[model samples]
Target chain A: MKYFLYGGCSLEAGGKNYMVSLEPVCKALGMEFEEIEDWNCCGASISYAGANELSIMTLNARNIAIAESTGGYDIVAPCSSCYIQLVKTNHELKEDAELRNKINVILKEGNLNFKGSLNVRHLMDVLYNDGGIDKIKSTAVRPLKGLKVAGYVGCQTVRPYGEYDSVERPKVHDLLLKAIGADPVPFPKKMQCCGSGIFLTELDRCLGLVKEILDDAIANGAQLISTVCPMCALNLEMYQDKVNAKFGTNFNMPVVYLTQLMAVAFGMDLKKEAALDYCVIPPEGIIKAAIGG
Target chain B: MAGNYDPSFAKEVFDNVDSGEEIKMCMQCGICAGSCPLRHEMDYPPRQIFTLIRAGRRDEVMNSKAIKLCTSCYRCKVRCPRGIPVIDVMHGLAHYGIKKGIIPRKGTAAFGGEFWKMIYNIGRIDEKTLPLKYNLLEGLVPGIKSTIEMAPMGIQMFLHHRMKLLPERKIKGIKELRKMLDKAKEMGKGGAN
Candidate 1:
């Protein structure tokens, strides 16, 4: 399938390893991504405080028009926030003609227009739906062989859309985990908020939220948490020390991107393909034990 | 509370805020508050905020940190029995608050201002610069103190190569982007048309 990538700001900076590991995983799955030229920030969840609906929508509308200008290939946003903004734009524009016309008028300033002809997808959705579980399993050279994983879906991936999976009880991430031969533990807080960008502003409150999610995952006996969203991965991985500091909990759990685990299972290099060293809370020891490298 | 009430506040919200009309559907169900991950942090939960809007508690609603503190988790949106897009309304209130020059939460407002300005100016964000700029919003002394507080993480990220020391280049289409954004703001000047 033709796919154009919209790697949001986090993937370019803080979550660079996510994009690194995703490369090999997609290649192994025969998925090719061409980066969308001159794509702007999705405005993310923070846009709500700073911009009105029309402005944020116009920001994403530019991206949609950019993709349409080129073959209109399906846009795959690795970040959950980017996916939501893009999809929200498409959903809103398709439903509201007056809004679409207004946005189109704004787009004319950029010498572009939004036709809403293509699909805006999260990489997790693209992997689970387009690349079937069995296909992923077949390509795995070395399956994980029942390493306990908490498949954290985070918020925006399944919520509000719920097209491919149940919003309340998402299982696609777990299903994908199972395909790689990892045992997905019954993680009740899998869909819980990780506080996203709020971490930077409200440190204490955000840490409280992160603490609960980590506490739940650890309680369920997860060796490591496999996540899809960049913001989720960054928050869950980087804030563990702070959570432990504030909450006085002795917790040291590894947080891995879903693609990183797939990279290991597919028998790819740990340092090169998986980019395991970049992780804040490294999973190398547990990962090595799982695959017996 | 009576001193701060304005009877037309509800209608103003309904007409101006994004998805603000949907607040009318909220039946005072506390499911939104119960579902909120940061309910403790909020001065008034989503349910109470809606009731405040209807009660014409304009200043209380706008000045409360509840609206600006939303994490956008979509938990309330998914679980609401009334199908209220709670996240949107909360964010809409936040945007409306800022537009009216009432900052409910200083830190959130400061960070969001820098974030949006970065995006608007360059069409993309330089993660390293965003926090630095946000810290400096209060002045150089506070900025230095805040930056010092975050120095450890910054150094760690720099070591890990997660943050670039060099300035980020503007996108090729930044001019066009600015034009579109200028027009969007102009059209939205009359408030939520």
Candidate 2:
């Protein structure tokens, strides 16, 4: 199967490894990634919050135009915020004629067109649902034997429109871990909001919320966390220091993309896809224990 | 804060915000507020914001940082007994606040301005440029000081290949994209599209 990859802004910056690790892993599973040409930022919350709904929709629709120009429908975005922005725009433009017309007029000025034919997808949706867990098992040369992971899907990917999964409680991510020979820890707060960007505006509240999520993972005996969103991964990985400084806690959880683990399970060499070095807390010892030297 | 309420505020929300008309369905259950992860930081949580709107507290709702600080998490909307689109209303309030010549939160407002400017211009955000411009928005001294303070993280990011020292190049069709965005700005206030 083929998918158009929308890396969003974070992928080029905070999520370079996500883009780095995704390509080889997907190829191993016989999946193709065609990057959307000249794709712009998804106008994440802060950017969109400043603009009116029409302007927001038009900007997202422009991305749809780029993706559609690639002559593909299934466009996969690794960042949940980007996935939501594109998918939500796809849904709205398909349903609202006024929105569709407005976006088309804007596209006309740029000499492009949007037909609302593109299907927006998060990478996990394609990996587990579309590609099927059976394929992941077939591609696995090394199972994640000793790893205990908590799957953090966050709120954006599941809300409003989760085509192939549940919003309140998703099971596919956990199912992916189980298929890969890892222990999928039971986490009640898996779908909870991690305060998203409130970290920028309200530090105290953001810390409290992030601490609650990490505490749940720790209490559940998770060695590390698996994430689908770049922002969620960053909040879990980068904020551990600040969170520790403020609360005097001794939590040292390593956050990683699900694909990184998938790559490990598929027997990809650490040299080819070493995610621990990219993580804020080096999970080298934990990774060694899971996959061995 | 009394007698400062605009009776027309509720109608304005109903008319302007997406699913804002559903504000009347809110029963003060505190579900939205309780579900919010940042409710502690909100001056008027969703339920109270709805009540204040009904009470016509124009200044309160408009000026509250809650609107601007909303993280767009969508927990309240999913759990709302009234099925209110809480995030949309919050965002609408934010845009409305900006339209009313209100500066909700200067730091985030600056971040938003810089982000939009980058996206509108180059079709991509230059991670290095964004923070540099954002910190420097206050002026040279503070900008350099903050930049120095952030040097550690910046170096870390550089090592990780997250922050490229070189500016990101514009996309091939950036001129076309700008034309559309520029036209959008002209229509922003009228919102007629």
Candidate 3:
């Protein structure tokens, strides 16, 4: 089936290395990616805080309208924030006509209209539901037998309003991790915030918030923390030294984007995949140590 | 250190709190407390904090070190069987206490509080001035050693064009941001006890 690949601002800004790999993987799996034509920022974190309900809803609604206009019901967003915001706006618009009307007025500025006729899904949800774990198992060229991976869902992916998975204890990421043949490490802080949204502004608080989550992953015996969001990956990777210095604790957990790990499990070349270039703590040494590559 | 406190203070805090979830639904199973990393360091663990709040110890609850230690990780809130949103209530109380100067500012420990102020005062965070600002407010040295150590990284970051001195590239929504901050500050101050 043809899907509208909703690569939001993070992807547009070249922040999502995972999305780069995901494009090929999806194509190989017989799924066609039709990018939403000329989509703007979902307003990311700022839109929710800055605008009224209608403005934010309509802004996201415009993108949904574009996808619907293409006759594409499934809009697969690789970015967790984009998926959450688009889905949330869709739900709100569908439930509240007054909100929908108000947002439509704003969309009129750009000569666009939103009828709320699309389903926004995270890449994880689409893969797990449509293709299923069996498809993943069948496609595995190499098995991730020994690697212990902690699946981090983050706040936006599975919470605030629970539509995708269990809000309190999400296992969608874990299911995806296992589907790729990696051992999913069970940790209580899976759905915690990585503090990346406010990291640029609130350095200490962000560091503290991330450190707590990372420590929990390490304590739970996770060798690497795998996440879907680039910000979460960047925060967890780039800020390790800062967190170590601030907390006076040794936490050497490497952060990998979920796609990177999946690619690795799929037997994609480590150097060709460019996983080592993106990692703050190189995965080569760890992978070599783990599997004797 | 203030032992002379009203017993109903915690109750008042609890009563005034809008957890957005039912507090009575808590099973008091200590899963929240057990799972909390800051539990050992807290004077009142998550369970005790709940108990004290339920007991109406408003002043004690507001002024407790327990609230200060919370990283707002939502571990307790997530793990709570009843889904009490304990972190939300704690955040409210912590904000209340900080405004009234009941809780001494413990530098970067109160990073959330300082963040609100920084955003409110300046349109955006000035990355060049952040180290000095953070160090001074946190009672740590904004010393030469730290700067020297950071220099290579900073220079590399600059060379790579990763770091920006001024935050606002084109002053996107600066006026609206100012107005929003003003409104937020007014609301925060007006809501204080």
How high is the CA lDDT of each candidate model?
0.87, 0.79, 0.63
What local lDDT does model 2 show for residue A34?
80
Evaluating just chain A, the predictions reach TM-scores of 0.98, 0.96, 0.93
lDDT tens digits by residue: candidate 1, A64-112: 8998999857889889889888988988898889999999999999999
Taking the tens digit of each residue's C-alpha lDDT, what string does model 3 give over B1-193? 3345466665455444434135567778988778665566578876776776666566656668776555444556656777676765665555556655676435423444444344434433344454445445534555565566556545543442334444523123344444433333333322323
lDDT of 2 by residue, B83-156 (tens): 77788777777777676678768777777777888887888878777778988998999999978866776777
**Which CAPRI level is candidate 3?**
incorrect
lDDT of 1 at B87: 91
- If scored against the real structure, what TM-score would every candidate get? 0.97, 0.94, 0.65
In candidate 2, stretches whose alpha carbon ends up further than 4 angstroms from where it belongs are: B14-29, B188-193
lDDT of 3 by residue, A63-130 (tens): 78767777845888887767766877788788989767766655555556678777888887777778
| Candidate 3 reference-contact recovery | 0.01
* Candidate 3 C-alpha error for residue A114, in Å: 0.8
Stronger candidate by DockQ (1 vs 3): 1
Q: What does candidate 3 score on TM?
A: 0.65
